[model samples]
Every structure is written in structure tokens, then in C-alpha cells.
Target: MDFSFLPKYWAYFNYGVMVTIMISVCVVFFGTIIGILVALAKRSNIKILEWLVSLYVWIFRGTPMVVQIMIAFTWMQFSGLPTISFGVLDIDLTRVVPGIIIISLNSGAYISEIVRAGIEAVPKGQMEAAYSLGIKPINTMRYVILPQAIKNILPALGNEFITIIKDSSLLQTIGVMELWNGAQSVATATYIPVEPLLFAAFYYLMVTSAMSGLLKLLEGRMSNGGKA
Candidate 1:
């Protein structure tokens, strides 16, 4: 097929790439925070807290992300967003709120398990040793356990970052002009479906491949007797 369509919409493609990257960064940042909280909650001594976190993880991880996005979009459209009467500083939360919330909640569910596993991988003696020195649990986790857990989980987090890039395309369904959405728009406008899609696929390949290489390098660094 002719990829002649690429040049015509190069600007649009660039915008799509930026939007994709922007949304993915937001998702990863918020998702990681939510995941850490969920992971800690799951291990909490309170039965109610653990049960609530478990339910959240179950619902988010069990359902399809597309469905969640669709539902979130529908809900936002009906409810609209909060309005501020500030002069030139009013925030429009409607457009982005649904997408960010849905994607982060979904990603957080998966990341929670990854984080839980990483933390668990550390030996129990580490905590015992910290406690033996009269260390507070929070300080013990922050200074000792979490540092090791982060090292172990860095590769998985990188993988999740790559996954978020691809998955952000789902936001296109809600009329977000992300990479796939740009391609779909191009295909419809140009009447050349395959090539525009292929062009978008090329960008996705480049992004994911680059992230994979970076993850491998990080893994090597972390594995070399913790040198890096």
C-alpha cells in the first residue's frame, strides 16, 4: 500500500504523538500513586480497608478497559464538569477528567499487584532488622524496604509505561485525538485506511520498541550487583 498519505497529515500525526505521550505520562504518574496506596491498603491490618481495596482491584482488573472508558465518557457527558467563575483562570475539567480517571484507575489495579509482589520479594528479616533498631514502620519501609522494592519493580513499571502508550489509544473512542484517532481521522479524510493506520502503527512500534530497550538497559543496571 502507498504510504503517500503520511506527508499530508504529518502535522496532525505530530499532534497525535504529543497527545498520546501527554496522556500516558499523566496516567503513569497518577496510576503509580494510586497503586502504591492500594498495595499498602491491601496489606493493612484493618479488614475493611483490605476488603475495599480488594474490591476496587477486582472490579477494575476484571472488566475491559474500553468498557470502563466508554462508561466514564458517558457519565461525564451527562454530568458535565464543575464550573469556576474565575477570570481567565477557569478550569475546564470535563474534557480530560474522565479519560484520566478511567485510565489511571485501570492501570492502578494492575500496578498494585506488581508493587505488592515487588515489596513481598524483599525478605521479612529486613523489616525485622529495622524494627530491632527501634525504627518506625513508615521509616523502615521508606529507607529500607521501598528502596529495594523499587529496584525490583522498575522494569515492570517501565513495561507498564509502554503499555500505557498503546492503551491510551482507547481514548480515541471518546473523541480524544490520540495516535490511533489521528490515523482513523486521516483514513476517513483521505479514503486510504490501511496506509494511515500503518503510519500510526509505525509510531507505536517506535515508541514501544524504544521503551523496551530502555527497560532492558535499566534491568541490566539494576542486576549488575546493584551498581547502577
Candidate 2:
């Protein structure tokens, strides 16, 4: 209940917040790219590609993310990833890399289904019209299908981003120095575990709430024909 430790350890919590946002952003970016590709492949009408993508989605979705993170961490440790410097920031690939990869892959599996649903929701006539005009299949998809499908997919993508923000806390288990991990560090240093965790909960609530509000606004604009 004593939060006198805040002044001493607030910086650590702030750093944790930064790491959480960084990881979630990276996961969402990479996951969306992977999801779009996988969704397109599943819709390709190619049996082998469809089967392979289905198996991938099945495995990632069926298994626990924590287990995946642990396995990825151990594998990356064995193989080793190089640390890279971004200006003054030294990114420890050994820690962040595994978490990013695992979480992005996990998110991609789920997002693929959402993307597929969105793509399918697009009118078949739109695709046929593009093809009748001598457009290549890829071009038809790129110019005609995806743009329309994106409107349907945007809300789900927002929800996925929210999910990733919370799930990034799991990276703390592998010493990724995210929000939950920062709270743990503060707890150990201050011997006031509950307060630090409460701080993390508050921070998380603020972030998710802000994101949810933005998403609702965007959805409203889209629903209203992009009117402000």
C-alpha cells in the first residue's frame, strides 16, 4: 500500500513501458505483414499452400504462447543472435529477438484468420470486375481486394494490438525488461511488491483504454463514410 517507492523507481517503470510499447509495435507490424501473406496463401486455391498454412495456424493457435517463448528463447540462445546498436541504444538481440519472433508469429497465426475473413467478406463481383479488365490476379488483389478488405480488418487489427500489448508482459519471463519485469525489479528493490504491480496494472489500463478509444473513433469514421 505504501507507494513512497515511486519517486525512487518510477524511471524503471517508465523504461518498462517503453519496452512494452516497442515490443507490441514490432509484433503488430510484423504480425500484420505475415498475416496478410498467410491469408492470401490460404485463399490461393492451391492445395499444398492452403494445407501448410492451416497447419501453421493450427499449431501456433493450439499451443500456449509461454511455451513457445521458452522454446524460442532456448533455441536462440543455442544459435545466438547478434546485438545491434540503434544510435545510442544497444538492443540485446539475445533477449528481445526471441520474444519478438515468437510473439509476432503467434499473433500472425491469429491475424491470418481475421485477414482471411475480411478478404472473403469482399464482394466476389469486385474481384471478377478487376479480372475482366485484364488485371493480373495479384494486381486485382493488391488494388481491388485488399483495400476493401482492410476496412473490415481494421477493427480486428486494433483488438489484436491491444492483445499484444498485454501479452508482451510474458517476455518478462525471459528477462526482456518489459513492464511486468520492471515492476518485478522495483518490487525486489523496494520490497514493496504489491505497489509496483499496482503501478503496472494502472499503466496497462491507461494504455489499453487510450488505444480502445482511438480504435472506436476510427471505426466511427469508417462507418460514417470517412466523415469527421
Candidate 3:
């Protein structure tokens, strides 16, 4: 097989790789924030808030992400409403923005439970002691709870990051032109399917493997200090 095409198409592949990374990073950032809020809501004292969060998590986590993406894209098309708009400034949001939002919202559902489990894994005694010390609930959570919870959550969160990195490939269905899309484009253009696609697979493996290694190092460091 001629391997020379790689150098010739390096720029396209690189651009696609960057787009893939951007989508994964955006998903991780926004997904984590949304997950935290949902987890908090799930743990809320208010019954209605807890129910609402539970429903949100149930729907997203129960459904397939591809279906959600299809629904989102179709809704955007049918609504003919921009995913984001500044009415005063009259600026339109790009397709990538909505794509990121859709992916993050879907990912956030699963992350919520991960976060909730992490938060709950903290000892009850710590919270009781904080309360006995006259610490406000919010302050107690901010200072004592979340910091301890994070150690428990970090490994799972890292796994989620890796999952998002692979799942971002699904965005190609919406014309995102990410790594998978690049491989497909090259395959169609050159009439050679296997090589380019294999290359894309190799790239994905490289990225996720590196991430797993980093996460292992972090886990070791955190564990060295004792269990959270």
C-alpha cells in the first residue's frame, strides 16, 4: 500500500484532529459543569428539584446519544432557529456550538451520576463534624465535601474524558468534519478505504492511551496521600 498519501493529506488530517480535540475539550468542560449542577440538584432537599434532575438524567442516560444528536439536529433544522443568537447584536451561532452543546448535554447525564456517587462516597462523619463545628452547609460542601469527593471522582472523570474523545466521532453525522469525517473524505476521494480509516483509528488509540497513562499517574499520586 502506498503510504505517501499521508504526508500529502497531513494538513487535512491535522485540521480534523484539532477539531476532534476541540469538541472533546468543550464537551469535557461544559459537561462537567452541567454534571455538577445536575448532581447537586439530584441531591437537593427540595423534592421538585430532585425529581426534575432525576428526570433529566433518566431521559438522557436511558436514550442512545445518536438518537439525541439526530433529534437535536432535526429540531434545529425544522425550527429554523439558530442554536444561539444575540437578538441585540444579530450574531448567529455556528453549527459547531450547537454540536458541542448537544454532545455535552448528553454526556452530562452520565457524568451527573458519577459525580453524585463521588460526592456521596465521602464519609458522613465528615459532614456531621463540619456541621457540629458550626460550618454553614454551603461552606462545608465548598471546603470539605467537594475537595474530598474530587479524589474519588477524578479517575472516573478521566475515563469520561476518554469516552468523550471517542464519542466525538459521532458528531460527523452532523457534518462536523472531525477526525472520522476526515478519514471518510479521504477514503472517498482516493477510492482507498482501509488505509486512511486505519490511520484515523491509530490516531484515536494514541490519544486515548496517552490519556489513560496520565490518569493512572494522577490516580497514583492521589492515592499516595491516602484514600479520600
Candidate 4:
């Protein structure tokens, strides 16, 4: 009922917001790279590669993300990371590194499917036309297929970014000090659990809403051939 604690604890939420954004950005970036590779491998027509990529997607997407984080955290404990300072940001690699890796891998599995669908949506004739022009398969994909496919799947990729933003809360369990973790710290300090959590929810809503607006604007520009 009382938000008088806001002034006293705003810094915790601010730091948490920053950490959440950083983790989400890293996850989306690395996940997109992994997904592109996996998608290409799945479509590579080599049975071995397809099988391996398929298995990876199955294991990662089939399992819950929290469990993956736990497993990765435990694994890292044996050979964990040392503290890394970055001016205002001090990273505890033992938690932050493993949290990012596991979440990115999880996002990668889902993204692989999105990318594969995008790639498939491209007309076969385009690929064949490139090949007919003596273009290497790699060059064909680079110059022709991927560009169209990325546009086709831009909405889905944006949704994935939003999903990662929410999922970053799970990193709190590993002591990564993301948004949810920051809320928990404030809850402990303020002795008012529900208020802090409600405040955190407000931040999540604001972020996702802003992201959705940006994506709509981007989609419109791309749809309009980059016109204003």
C-alpha cells in the first residue's frame, strides 16, 4: 500500500533493469547466431548433421529452462568463473556466465524452428534460380534466400526477443541479480514482498509494451521499403 520505500530502493530496481536488458540482449544475439547455424544444418541434406541438430533441438526445447539453468549452474561450480569488473557493472561469472549460456541455448532451440520455417517459406524457385546462375549454395543463401526469409520471420524473431526478456527472470535463481532478483532483494530489505513484486511487474509490462511498439514500427518501415 505504501511506496515510500521507492526513493530508498530505486537503485536496486535500476540496476536490476539494466542487468535484465543486458542478459536479454546477449541471449537474443547469441541465440540468433546459434539458431541460424542449426537451421542451416537441419536443412543441409546431410543425414548426420540433420540428426545432430534435431537431437539438440529436442533436448533443449523439450526440457524446462529452469532445469537447464540448474544443471548448467551445477556443472559450472566445479570450474566456475572469477569475478570480472566492468566499471559500474561487476559480473559474477560463476552465475552470470552460466545463466546467459543456458538461456541462450534454450532460446536457440526455439529460434532454430522459427528460422527453419522462415527459410522454408522462401520460394524454391529463388534458390534454383541462384543455382542456375552458377551461384554457390552458400552464396545463394547469403545473397538471396536469407534476406527474404529474415523479413518473413521478423515478427517471430521480435516475439522471441520479448520472450527472452520475460524469461530472464529465471536467472534470479542462479543469483544473476536480474530484475526479479532485484525485486527479491528489495522485498527482503523493505519487508514488503508484494509491493516490490508489484513494482517489478510494472517494469516488465512497461518494457514489453515498449518493445512491442518498436517492433510494430520496424515492421511498418520494412514493409514500406524503409519509408518513413
Candidate 5:
């Protein structure tokens, strides 16, 4: 129960925090794009495209993310399928790549629904008006529907980003050395579990709380602007 170990191990904790942030940023960046695409696919007029997107969302959402990461990493390593290759060179995808992919895919499943809900939240009148203006469906979505929908969904998207920040901890199970892994490493090395674990918890709390505050501020501004 040495309280003094916190300051001594702050550097390791900081490094871990940085890695966690990096992973979360990467996950959100790619995941948002994937989610938007999936959302659009789910709403496609083509039945096959809608069905495929539905299946993807159901499978990823139904499974545990840790299990998904394990499977992805193992498959990449053992499948002998080159993740990327040029004419003469091949690159093997490792734990980190699959780890990020799994997390991003999982995040996309949830974000897709958020996006779908956002799109649906727009009034039918908006769609009809766009159509009356001779706007193609794609342009209606691009210029009118999605912009309005995004405004409605910004708060939810922020919440999902915060969720991603926390869920990034699960990557530690695969030896990705994110925040939780760093805390675990410190605990194993120093034999003082509580302090390091608490430090990690504190870091998570700080991040999530800051995100919540920012989202709230953004939501308020949007609300005020809408009123204006």
C-alpha cells in the first residue's frame, strides 16, 4: 500500500494514457466512416445490400469484442493470407492491426444504429421537399438529410466516442499495451496493485468526464443555434 509509488510511476502511466488516446482516435476515425457506410447500406433500396449490412451489425453486436479481437488476431497470423502485398513484398498483419480493426468494427456496429436513428429522425417533409426540388436521392442525403441528421446525432456520437475510449481497455487482453495494459504491467512490476490500477481508473475518469462536458457544451450550442 505505498501511496508514493504513483508519482514514481507517473511516466509509465502517461505513456499508457497516450497509447489509449491514440488507439481511441484511430478507432473513432475509421469507425465513424465504417459506421456511416454501414448505415447507408442498411438503408439501401437494394434488398441484398440491406441484408448484408444487417447481418454485419447483428454479428458484431452479438459477440463479445474481446473474442472478436482474439479471433481476428489469430486468423491473421495463421491464415497465411497476406494482409497487404505488392508485386514482390508482402506485409503480415499482426495483433495491433487486427486489434484496431476489431475495435473499429465493433464501434461501427453501434454507430451505425446511431446514424440510422439520426437519419430517421429527420422529418419526412424534409425528404419530400428535397425530392420536390429535383434533388437526387444521393444529393438529398449528401446535402440536406445527412447534414440535418448529423446535427441531431452529434450528442449520441460524442457519447459513443467516450465509450470507445473506455472500450479501448479491452485491447489489453491481446497485449496491445494500451492504458489498462500499462497499469497491469506496472502492478506486476512493482507488486503494488491498487495504486497503479487506481491511476488507470483516474485517467479513464478524467477522459470520459472531459468528453461528457464537451459533448454537453456542443449540444447546448447546437440547441441555441437551432432556436435562433
Candidate 6:
């Protein structure tokens, strides 16, 4: 009831909000690329590459996400690893890098499955027809297979992005100042837990709902185009 504390500690909340959005966006973009690669390797004839992809996916997917974050963070800290300087901004890679890497790896494992399923759902005849027309394998996947497969996978990818948005909250364990971290800091400063947490929850709800709405609109367009 006493969210009077919100105005007092808005800066911390902003930090948390920014961290979550930045991390989730970077993770989703890079994760999808990594996922596509893994999916391709899974379906490729190269035995050793397929095996390596399997191992990476298995390790990332099977293990707890928090464990990955901690391991990456701890390794970087203990190794005295250097932070990245981007001219105007310096990134503490020990914090942001590990958080992004862990989340991206975890997402890549799951997204790989989504992508593979999408690739499989495309009709085999499509690939055969492209081949008969003398399309290269790369061109077939690029121009023929992927566009159709994306329609089936878009919703699932949106959901994964939502999941990443929420899951990044756990990065507080590795000293990433994400959403939950904002709540915790406000709670500690104000000695009022529920209101700060509720505020954080409101931000999460707003972001996820907006993303869901956009995905629905995209799906509608996709469906309508198919009809036309």
C-alpha cells in the first residue's frame, strides 16, 4: 500500500529496467543466430559437428541457468579478465558478458529445438522440388525453406523472447542489476519489500503483454497473407 517509496528510489528501478531490456534484446538476437546454427548442424551430415552441437545443447539445456551464470561470472572474476571498452562506455564483461552469454546459450539450446521443428515441418516435397530445379542447398534453405518455416516458428520465438525477459531477472545472482535486483535494492533501502517488488512485477507485465500483442498482430498478418 505504501508505494510512496517508488518516487524516492526510481533511479534504481530504471537501472533494473534498462538492464533487463538490454540483456533480453541482445540475448534474443544472438541466441536465434546460434540456434539456427545448431539446428542446421543437427540436420547436417557432418558427424563431429553434429555431435559437438548436441553436446553444447545438452549442457546448456539440461543444466540449471543459474549455475551457468555463476560459473561464467566466477571464472571471469577469478581469472582477472579485462572489461570491454566501447569508447564512450566501458562494459564490465565479468557482469554483462557472462549474463548475456549464459542466457544466450540457454536460449540457443531451446530455440534450436524450435528451429529444428520448424525446419522439419516444412514439406519434404518443397526441398525436393527446389533441388530438381537445380537450386543449391544453401539457396534452398535460404530462399525456399526458411521463409516458410519462419511462419510456423514466429510465435514460439516470441514466447522464447518473453521467457528471456523474465529469466534475466535471475542475473542478480551474478551481480547484474536487472529487474529483481532493482526491487531488492529498493526494498533494502526502504525496508519495504512488497511495494518495490510489485512495481517491478508491473513493469514485467507491461513488457511481456506488449510483446504478446505484437506477436498476435504479426501472426494475423501472416495468416491473412497466406489466404491472399
Per-residue lDDT of model 1, residues 71-189, tens digit only: 98888886767744333233335655688899999999999999999999999999999999999998998899988999878988998999999999988888877789888999999
lDDT of each: 0.87, 0.91, 0.84, 0.91, 0.86, 0.90
Tens-place lDDT per residue, model 5, 1-228, is 566777777777777777778778889999999999999998889999999989999999999998999898888766454445433323234656787899999999999999999999999999999999999999999999998898888988998899999998887877767789888998998888788898889899998998899889988988888889
Return the TM-score for candidate 6, rounded to 2 decimals: 0.94
The predicted structure with the larger lDDT, 2 or 6, is 2
Runs in model 5 lying further than 4 Å from the true structure: 78-93
Which pairs of residues have clashing backbones in candidate 3?
A: none
List ranges where model 6 is wrong by over 4 Å: 78-91
**TM-score-sorted candidate list, best first:** 4, 6, 2, 1, 5, 3
Candidate 2, residue 75: how far the Cα is off, in Å:
0.6
- Deviation of model 6 at 89, angstroms: 9.0
Error of 2 at 173 (Å): 1.2
Clashing pairs in 1: none
Instruction: List ranges where model 4 is wrong by over 4 Å.
Output: 226-228
Q: Please give, for residues 80-191, the per-residue lDDT of candidate 3 as tens digits.
A: 5464432322213344666788889988998998999999999999999999999999999889999899998998999999999999888787777788988889888888
Model with the higher TM-score, candidate 2 or 5:
2
97-167: candidate 4 lDDT, tens digit per residue: 88899989999999999999999999999999999999999999999999989888899999999999999
Screening candidate 5 with a backbone cut-off below 3 angstroms (N, C-alpha, C), the clashing residue pairs are none
lDDT of 5: 0.86
TM values, all candidates:
0.91, 0.93, 0.89, 0.96, 0.90, 0.94
- Of the candidates shown, which would achieve the greatest TM-score relative to the real structure? 4
Each candidate's clash count: 0, 0, 0, 0, 0, 0
lDDT of 6: 0.90
In model 5, the worst 10-residue window by lDDT is 84-93
Q: Could you give the C-alpha RMSD of every candidate to the true structure, in order shown?
A: 3.6, 1.8, 4.4, 1.5, 4.8, 2.1
